[model samples]
Target: MADEEEPKTAFVDESAVPSAQASGEENGSLGNSWSEVSDMRQGLHQRHVQMISIAGTIGTGLFLGSGTSLARAGPVGALLGYTIIGAIVCNVVLAVGEMGALLPLSGGIVRYTETFVDPALSFAIGWNQVYSGCKSTFCDKSGKAATLIQWWITINNAVWIVVFGSVMTVSTLLFVRVYGEMEFFFATLKICLIIIVNVTALVVVCGGGPNGVATGFTYWRNPGPFVQYLGIEGALGRFLGFWTTFSNAAYAYAGSDSIVVAAAETRNPRQTIPHAAKRVFARVAIFYIITIFFVGLLVPSDNEQLLSASGTAASPFVIGANIARIPVLPSVINAIVITSAWSSGNAGMLNNSRYLFGMAKHGHAPKIFLRLNRFGVPYCAVLLITLFMSLAFMSLSKGAATVFTWLQSLVSIGALITWTTISVTYLRFYYGCKAQGIDRNELPWKSPFQPYAIWASLFFLVLIMLTSGYKVFLHDHWATESFISSYINIPIFLVLYLSYKFINRTNIIPLSEIPIRPLLEHAQRFPEPPEEPKQGWKKLNIFWN
Candidate 1:
């Protein structure tokens, strides 16, 4: 299937018409009408988009994985790592916001890559996202399974995997609004939990808790705020620890890039997408950075329970709550962690299904994926992606479980590649605008910094991808699987991009040849809907809704 020939449809470089019309003119003879066929419903509101951007990212990565990072890198290392990655995330989100507002499509950046960059790039990134989403869902369920048994010791993890997987699949197959509402509620729960936990952590850090023992920065001073990596001594070791924590930070922010993927199903995307993208920085600052800071202050980095296999103990916040002697807060936090993990799986399902549907619409995937039901849900694509959710069952087997971990590692690389591609595509689009004498001010949205931000993000992303597994290359630290998991996707991405270019005889689209006019005209034709004033206390919805 990887080597399948590209469709020999005529390439219409002109953009006097909309993309759907132009595609019909060039590919009509090939029965390629799916691009014109609207299979998705714009059932999502501005509130749903905002919530999804927050909910998709604030999952096990921040809640559970942060514990491991603290234990490995110490308080200072973890803070620096998350702070750096958060800045990169801000840049990527800004770039995506500018592009998505101009061309708000179903698959967001995946579709943008096809139109603004290369179709071959789109193909590679699209499949990469789909695979990542599937693996993420599997991992979410596995983590949820582990957390579920913490509540009850008798049940097997396989049962929770099946149960959680089934629930997410059903929701994905439903109307898009159902999924949106589901995510909205889950995201609200997460936002509330973060606020509550952060405030409680502050209480513990100060002497407000029942224990009345002030523990302000005591852990940081005791642990000395830097862990030596692999028992290596010196600055190099601390640097390695920070670098390792940087990778863990990536996992915390994984699904963030896909925040705009559902734009095609959102109302007034020209307004909502850019608006939602702007909120990401605040969310990261409050929910991630502040929370991590307090978690470090409350929970010592050297505590063994930070790396515990048990769900409750592995949570730094839960452990801190226990130490503060907060009545019943530990159990409450544990339950929220389980729900957040399950929520991540649901978000993954939504992203994967839409990605497949977008690919099918553009002829990058099988035609079966183009099928949509009465509610405009891409049922076929949902079912196909949901099939992979069964992989969660592999956790029951010892040997297959090891393979599952490797697969998860491969998927982790996909986000880095996707972010790199986003910056690259934005650069191409930026240059294309300049060459064509287009006014950037006329665009619906514009990023703060231009080519510099794009280049810096690209350079850093590539550097991280190359060095993600640097430890494996150190003397006496070599491991075959670790080496492959870190570097394998680089070659795989190249193969996919090069092979598609070769098969299709695709060329680097010249700036003048790029189709920007029709897109701008289309966007202008659909001006954003005006906001209605809210009366009374309902106006507070503007804060988060």
Candidate 2:
């Protein structure tokens, strides 16, 4: 591959780009922008990258939350909800993959925001995601705090909180391979859990369980495939309930950008990152959609346990197992779910810290965060962001539950905004490539469906955000909590973007001014190593490949 030479492509000056400086600070702790993309060590191997994506994407949200979705939206509505959200998330993964293959930069959407859109917007998204990302980690870790109690373990939550928190923290601080292997083990457990859940559901659906009731489609017929929200009998209530699924589904698929978040630290990223992205979407999408379909068949929407707040408590599969009179299944599902929560927390921490590190390198964050550890991680950024893990402790507080709920709302909205930003940023990159006479074929990876797919993702993401709190306005259904939680992030994002724009005095970059050619040419010069042939079991190992 290196022997083949191509015609020269013209490069552009980055200074012409908005708020983009190519130089590192005088101290040199912060490396040159494009030269080292935060200088993270490439400690993650091919399998590590794949497992991280798999482990992070499959979490408690899918394990237990699907039951609640079924209760609110019914079987048909829940299936529709997960399907639409999964498609949108798949689009996001594609967009991010295409960009990451070419740019191979850390910070994920934040880096792409600065390069393709505007640096100021990058500042907004970077800070917003940092806040919300930590909140998500809080959600996952707090879920773990509830795990012991949910399984009747009788352990002190605060004590286990420190222990879980310490394990997650130490894993991130060490060599990245340590994090990768740890997630690999967790991911293996998660996959096995999913297979078990699905198999058990299928068996019960076919009347193979202890009771052998053979209720095939019986519940769907009785519940009639839709819910009447707030006792508003008729199609209007069912429609409202169906609409609520988008919010719920969005919460489950929040971190779609994670696969490419560590491009700088991944081995052979041009190949590794995008390959992981493409496969992750397909695998994760099917896992959510098919699993939801099975869930609908196995459990009824009106079951009271579906109303439980914790995923383990409200898990449809667990409920299904209970219906089939399988006593050990609940504990098994609960154990797997505990691991899923911890796995997601590991991913959340790793991605958020990398975002901070990239922001520091790009002058959007404090330079102090540029400092890296001996293992090549941004130790300072990890240390600073780790403080937010304390927020998870609020879940243990009796009165802080409401505050935590509001924070979760804000975090969910933040995820919607993030996917929306990704769509917009990729659109800009697409047009900029066209304007500069760069061919998509020449890029390291090209996404199919182009601008149309991205536009659709953007459309649905906006619609979901706008309608997130629709229930609050449904005459006589107003709730202060719903109003605050639903629409609060809109103003917050606008204020962050606008305030940073005015304070920094930056302009929205013109398509012509975007330095796409330079980055593309850089990618051309430093090509990734050709992928080696897989032998024997590796070729047969469909899951990891």
Candidate 3:
């Protein structure tokens, strides 16, 4: 699956000036395609793009759910799981960024898939994302399983739901610059929290706390590194525990694709996106990997608090802090995480509307979704997507709550399906260039390592998807809900793809007809201005630069 045998491919160089530029054709193929001339406002700045990638994925999942991984896999096992997934996620984002640099289309990978692969594929993934994005935002972080939920007053879920729903709706419907800035501020706070947690954990590990007990590698050696998951013994149990964390780590890294999610709304996307892609991995390494390492060092996996469903009280940082006799950290982490939840929801809403807009543009969704407001936002799409926020109020009725659970079940596998489809689409694009004798360098940004990164990423992603519900098959673990949620999307995606393909009579686009040249020429004809070089103190802002 990695490579194909060399066929009689054309060797003619496509380096000459494209016909559109040579003829000064203003209304040629460049302006007609969906990838070109988006009506979406280009208001997201370079800093916004950079921070979107950084903060979009760092949510309560990292702050709270990370404890679950440590409990299951112990310290060393959990660290390995996050590290492995982090590397794969880096590749996934790079694949999206490479294409986005050239096309900079709205709907991120959805638009890219339609152009490089089959429109049917895009239709399938695009709707999948819309459904998942809308539902996940409400389902996420709303669980009662938290100790630090400092709600000012217990109010009706309906009222709070309406309030949050209104916020998401209004923010996305406004000028995109406003949305970008909101994300920028949220990302900055998340960054600071991670830094604080990591530093605090490191200090505690080094005996900086009142306990004055420097217990370096103490937890690792006492209970050992690997855990005997599900009461199974020895290496297999340890390996299973370690592997389960992949799913948890994946949840933590779920939204790394934000760099290209609103590509059309980004200013100077060609430069901004590639730079964001290159830096995102480093940011993840520093933030997630290093933080996880400290988590392992500071907290023992055997701690019962690690398994508790409580909020920041169960956060590994808080648990570690308490072990070192620090008390105020929980409130601090809790306060920021509430905002993070809202921020994550905001991102989901923005992404949901954009995906619908992209689908409508590609003729896969209702035409109304294409309607834009004075602010250049897909207002119609925003309204339609927010309808799902009503699901939040369903918890009021027991029967309705049951239905909501099943609804949530349907979207569990969406992220895995999304990543797999992205890899497949990118592979097609990578080879299409080869089959057409086009140089990759001709494009605005070419990701380092041809096919290998994506190929490896695809392999691991498929493995994770296959094993996602493995626990459901274990002794006494035959859960109907879990099984359905894990595997149902497989047939659903196939149905969406094959149904669209048969009805529309679509075929896998041949490499030669994939339209790389037209889009490349279009990009060249309207090249983005080169980014100005950094000067003086601005150079210190490495993360957002």
By lDDT, the best candidate is 2
Better of 1 and 2 by lDDT: 2
Off by over 4 Å in 3: 1-38, 142-148, 151-159, 393-412
Worst 10 residues of 3 by lDDT: 1-10
* lDDT score, candidate 1: 0.77
Total clashing pairs for each candidate: 0, 0, 2
lDDT assessment of candidate 2: 0.77
For residues 318-410, write the lDDT of model 2, one tens digit per residue.
788888899898888777777778888888889889999878867788888888776777888888767877776766666444654466567
Query: What is the overall TM-score of model 2 with all chains considered together?
Result: 0.93
Of the pair 1 and 2, which is ahead by TM-score? 2
- Give the whole-model CA lDDT for all candidates, comma-separated: 0.77, 0.77, 0.76
Q: Which pairs clash inside model 1?
A: none
Taking the tens digit of each residue's C-alpha lDDT, what string does model 1 give over 34-63? 242245667787888888886655788888
Among all candidates shown, the one with the greatest TM-score: 2
